[model samples]
Target: MTRGFADRIPVHIQQVVEAMVEVFVNQSENIGNEVDYLQVFELSVDTADFFSMQAIAHSREEPPYSTTTEFVTDTAITEKVYIISDDYGLEGEVITYLLASEY
Candidate 1:
């Protein structure tokens, strides 16, 4: 995770984010090769204190599947881009959370 994005994650919902990542991995893997290594996450603040996260498992050959969750917190998450990647950047099961501007 980029420092900016990591820092943007609300303190009270840290565990929620971690669990979301784990669930995203399982959904992607269960779908098999239909999904490519890269995954996408759409994050936003629906309300001033509400954070919405939509994790998408995308595939070039098929339509994307996504899972979403919402959190009510005292602080809103401002950073808003999520992609899955390894140290190599574009390949591997590792998922990364970072701001769109940072990339």
Candidate 2:
């Protein structure tokens, strides 16, 4: 079953996650008041581990962003996926895409 977006990351770690997202956004290229691209970070709750899942920036008009997931042994252990919508918005808009852990 899919988990709720808010439930993916524990309350204690949300701040850390958000801070990391902000750092990524600040470092990314700014294209005409909007971000040039988006980034998805796959995170593991058990190991406190995470990795980037590169995403292509879709039009702001698009409802859902487009992304590609390259399966690796470690990804199967991931418990949550954070989707950062590369746009003009501030860091407060980051969303977490929750995944059911297989391990």
User: Which one wins on TM-score?
Assistant: 1
Query: Model 2's lDDT to the true fold?
Result: 0.39
Candidate number of the best lDDT:
1
Evaluated at residue 61, the lDDT of candidate 1 is 22
- Lowest lDDT block of 10, candidate 2: 54-63
List lDDT for all candidates, in order: 0.55, 0.39
Q: Write the per-residue lDDT of candidate 2 for residues 1-103, one digit (tens) a residue.
A: 1255455555434444455555544544342233423334454423224643322221222222333333223223244443444333655543434432421
Alpha-carbon shift of residue 51 in model 2 (angstroms):
21
Runs in model 1 lying further than 4 Å from the true structure: 31-35, 47-63, 87-94
How many residue pairs collide in each prediction?
0, 0
> What TM-score would every model get versus the actual structure?
0.59, 0.40
Model 1 global lDDT (CA atoms, 0 to 1): 0.55
| Model 2 misplacement above 4 A | 1-3, 29-37, 45-78, 84-103
